[model samples]
Target: MKKLFFAAFTLLLSLCSFSQNYQLISGDQIKVSKYSSDLDIVASDKTGNYFAEQRWSWNLRAKLYKFDKNYNDIYEKDYRKELRGSIFRGFYPIDEELVMFSTEYTRKEKTFTLYARKINKTTGEIKQDAKEIGTFPLEDKRDDFEVKFAPVSNGKKLLFAANVSNKDRVSLVTAVLDPQLKREATATIDFRFTPKQFSIQDVFYTANEKIVVLGKESEETQVGKRKKKRWVFKQYILHIYTKAGKKEKEIPITADQRFAISGKLIEHTDGTLALAGFYATDPKKKDLSGFFLSKIDTDKNELLLTSYKEINASMIGQNYTEDADDDNDDDSKKSKKEEKKKDDDDEEEEIPNDYVLKSVLINPADNSMVITAEISQLYVYQTQNRSGNMTTYTTVYSYTTKDILLIGLNAEGKVKWVNSIPKKQQEKYENPNITRSEEDYFSGKTAHPYFSSFAALINKDKLIILMNDHQSNNVNPEYGHKVKRVYNFKKKSNFYGISVDLVTGTMKRKMIYDNSSDGIMMPRSAYINGSTILIPATRVKMFGKNELKMSQLTIK
Candidate 1:
């Protein structure tokens, strides 16, 4: 298994050529220095064609960029002419045409329309066939709900997750589109949730439409008291939906108290479906590991297939006794000093044992369901900084690891061999502002990390995740502005992109275009192109102005 994993890894890298400075497979690294104030990569056609709508500003001005088979610039135009809000939502393909849409932002008391447009594949012209599907009611102003596009049986469906602005009540709206992408039929779902002291983190179905949604919905209750009170996440929940919104089954990740579901649904040509994701359980006192795999399941929701366990992240810790040098006395003395130092280091910082991406996939045999997930780590540190710092100095700090965890379950839902990915090195980033802390952090606000990572499920067991590099601009010396210091306490995290193994939860690739090295990582947006991945990166103009830069990577 190790040899096979290595062979596959080597082959992936060999398929492309990358220089330390930049990575490219086709198209000279074009310097597209435009800011996509907001953007979304709709979908890559089966032929590997990419199309997306990139909004350039907070003021509702933006354009669309399309790429051909070779990733060459096919066309670009301003799609947001009179559209009020240009916040990006998602992309989907119908037949031979591409459809893209952005969220509607409200300005003033009046409400605007939620627009969806179709693009002409051959001419690369923007088709004004855009129509407003729904409106954001005054009672539904919360940012938790968003629209996602998926290919349905005939045309396509837009899945909108709706929940009460400040309540636990959640609703799933499935809007089927017509040939021109007009909303035809809609399904309102109360969906399903457990009453076991858990939250619905994600909601989606399998590739072949088998219902499967993942969430770190732990049976957690507060323990301890006041300042010392802590919430323990016991495990992960994997749900299989054999029927549409009717029947469902649940499973638990039983390794460590920590498991994160990251990946998508896969529909195979041979009438099989699978789910790809991983978990981060405490291997020892120091290792946070993960594994990725393709799960198989059938309509009845029985565990018929599973894969070999793959390692996600593992650290070399003080838990292991030292392999002393030949000189015992001197080495022993040094070891004692190092041991003390190691303990001190452990107090303030916690290493990321594993990182699983949250993505969805489909089974080629039948595009029946979707894969939705919201998996969180079992044991993670909630770093609090109250030392006069008003700005959130949040960033995903990375650590190295070896060992990839891979698992798979089949359509019959049989557990496959849980494989271990013995990778040599791995990397991780700090997530901020997403986790829940009953007591607001530092200045009375939640400071838990956001899952700034995303993934895409492709052919084979090969999955791709772009773990976003996040950092606060107000605190960043190079990026921060003077007056902006006043707003430091309320800034959001930014993202840069990285590639990791979906099966083994390992960093298979990393490249930063704007900074030469992995300076300030930002996942401006990404698009899939054959064996290559095109990521658009932006850097503030050298003159303190915003200037966007683009980076394209050919993954071997």
Candidate 2:
């Protein structure tokens, strides 16, 4: 009888081990830079076979690494050494062996040029000489210039657009280039608006081989014919242009005055337009109070503006962790204090509204769209003295991410449900207010090491949120469900995932893999291609040198 019991116990343990969400694929490891921000993973044409990564150094020096189907590094090289003072715009994959990149250079005085180069995928070498396609004349140091490249005509043609601004005038120059970098058609649009009033959000390719530009332009209206000099916010504007850059139709989306649209817009597979952002209820307060989702039917020229969801305590995963505080003695006093404060004031817990909208993804399986947002804020620190006084003032920036809000919208642009994956990530900024060093002129340390680190994988019936293990046993779970004690092979932990049901809004948190025995995974570097998820990690050994590794997880 005792032998039978031992055998049953071993069987149960084996069953639990095999039932994990992700299985690690070993033996595919390489060397990489310690800084995760420098790595950019590009999904290749071969669905789940191979991919490419571009790493940039502190001085904007770039190196491309190509990996094979088994996650083995095959080749790496540095291209375009002559164009040192250029900014990489985008990469276009023409075929399996050929890729092209666009860069904007502002080297000469009062001159800006856009260059395109074709790259060999196998060897990471430039296929042809870098060609200067277009140039823009700058106006002093205050002039703003930007160039973007997009693949139109079903990835057969490339469309390049440049936004040049001087004083109160902004000109948009667009050119369609073929695979040989030859410009087929070019046109320019000039418009005038208040300084900082007009901004181009995104340019996308339409199904009919035309281009659509999503923009936001603020307009001012007089109150009671008194001309109070107040600039009121208007609606979002859409400009549809033909292949030759001729303006075909101008569609205006009349939005609520309380809300603001983000620069990220989605042109869906079915000819519908959607935008995800925030709205403010209080006019005086410039902060966002809720999530705003707008769906536009371009065929009928109808806009839907009734899909706004408010951020509440329940949406931030506060309800689940609240009950666990009662059982733990160490947290009892803190929980009591919070309850006392709540009772003292007959008011509800104020949910924070400083979340910045990140991405709006569409799921054609169910005609549902998911909105992902994170809490982001900036702080400025300055040291000032009056009359020979030596004093220092430290202002810590809130680059920390408190929680990520996820909202689901159904086919009719109605709110399906809302959920939040709670997390706390904090770090200091190198400068006054810059969070990401890659965005600033000077490459410095990141504000929060894990600010925007979590990855959300959206599916038809569920969504998975994956990140590095930060909570472990430190976070309390709901009282009823027994939280499993996680064990790491080494001192450090591996990756964890929170799976949420799309329809019921139910969430289950579990450790995907305890890979501490091998390497420390950078969850922020995780990428999804079809049903496969790839994560890069750092492997430290007891002797010898450390190496960079990647984990491939296949979803069944």
lDDT at 442, model 1: 12
lDDT of 1 at 185: 49
Query: What tens-digit string does per-residue lDDT give for candidate 2 at 199-241?
Result: 6767765565565677767665553344455454555577776
Where's the lowest-lDDT run of ten residues in candidate 2? Answer: 1-10
Model 2 lDDT at residue 165? 63
Q: What RMSD, rounded to one decimal, does every model reach?
A: 12.7, 9.3
TM-score of 1: 0.54
Top-TM-score structure, candidate number: 2
Q: Give residue 358's error in model 2 in angstroms.
A: 2.6
Q: lDDT per residue, candidate 1, 1-556, as tens digits?
A: 0111111011122323321122443233333323333434555664544534343344435455556555556556555554454554445677666766655646554343456777666665667756777665433444434444545554344443333222444444445566666665444545344324344444444446554555444333443334343344455566665434554677764533544433334545444555555544552224444444444565666543354344422221111222233232122343335435644544423233233333434334333222223222222333334567563543432222222233333443333333332221112324522222322111111112212323343433344434342232211111111111110111223332333333343333432222333222333245655546655433333444343323445443
TM-scores for all candidates: the values are 0.54, 0.71
Q: For candidate 1, give the lDDT of residue 362.
A: 39
Error of 1 at 340 (Å): 18
